[model samples]
Target: MNIKGAIMRVFPEIPEFDEVDFSQYSTPYAAVLIAFFESGKSGLREFEEFVEKNGGTKADVGRFLISIFQYLLIRYRRYGDEKVEVPAFKVFLTLKGWLNENGFENDYTRLLHSFVGYLVDIAEKIAEKSDCELGLAYMKTAYLLTIEAEETFKEEYFSELKKTAQGMVAEIYRKCGINGGLPEKREKGC
Candidate 1:
């Protein structure tokens, strides 16, 4: 819903899309989310076509792409692997291509940090609407992304995002009956 709200802010002409019913995990909404994931695995053509069809400019599509990527990653962790094959390498390449085409290739640390923020929000949304397991999956995804971004970007913002993601993951694990949660200190061995 946050992603859809962000998209509508850019392309208001697009009508309201269907709300995803979390109870129905295999609903059309899930399929659409998987479609976005699959599209990203291949390339950004689907996103580009969406922008053109919706009368949006390249400059505006960056946030939209970022939003969908966050959602796609969430869905992938939730149900994508069971539904279809999604190679992680291809997704990484597509993300790189998105950054390059959207003019963030040279300096994308901020954008990646921004994505971590969205991931947190998405985890909260899933927590509210779906099972704690699904929410935990999103939190785990967010935490992993933060780790990767922190390694690649080395930005100060990533430290904060990583902490936020770690905190969320800890809370979710606590709720899931995993006491003590993840270690607060990042392991030197990891």
Candidate 2:
């Protein structure tokens, strides 16, 4: 999506702002993001306090925070190259939340779908590294997101993505040696 470019276009004042220094703000960003996910409004105050504590000037903190969030999502899909502060699931949650809040839910449905696909792609990459369980978890989360989108937006495209996510989940399950369907029992085998 070239989010960095979009940020540059939106905030020309921060013209010299290079790549987001995620490492410098990862802790606070994760904290405020988690707060936002939980309590919604509190995150704003927390974010302000964080900026103040971090010695940020009188710039647009709100927009800066949103940029950080959007960058987080952008980086999350980059897989192993970028160090994402928030978890993968939380990144998807925040992206969806941001879209809904900014009235882009309907307009950017395809972007959301692409993010879900990226999640699945990342999961497959993780599975290739012999982490099938984690891959399955991510695929399941993608499936859940697609289902929510289908129910909320009533779009046939989300339904198709849901089916694709389900197939991905099943593929990971097979890789994990579970055959098909849910596991009947948990066995502690060496």
Predicted candidate 1 versus true structure: per-residue lDDT over 22-106, tens digit per residue = 2322222333334444434223455556555556566555554454444445554666432111222223334556777567764
**Candidate 2: stretches off by over 4 Å:** 1-66, 72-89, 94-114, 179-190
lDDT of each: 0.52, 0.52
Per-residue error (Å), model 1, residue 13: 22
Write model 2 residue lDDT over 19-49, tens digit each, in one string: 4544433333343344333433334345456
Candidates' TM-scores? 0.43, 0.48
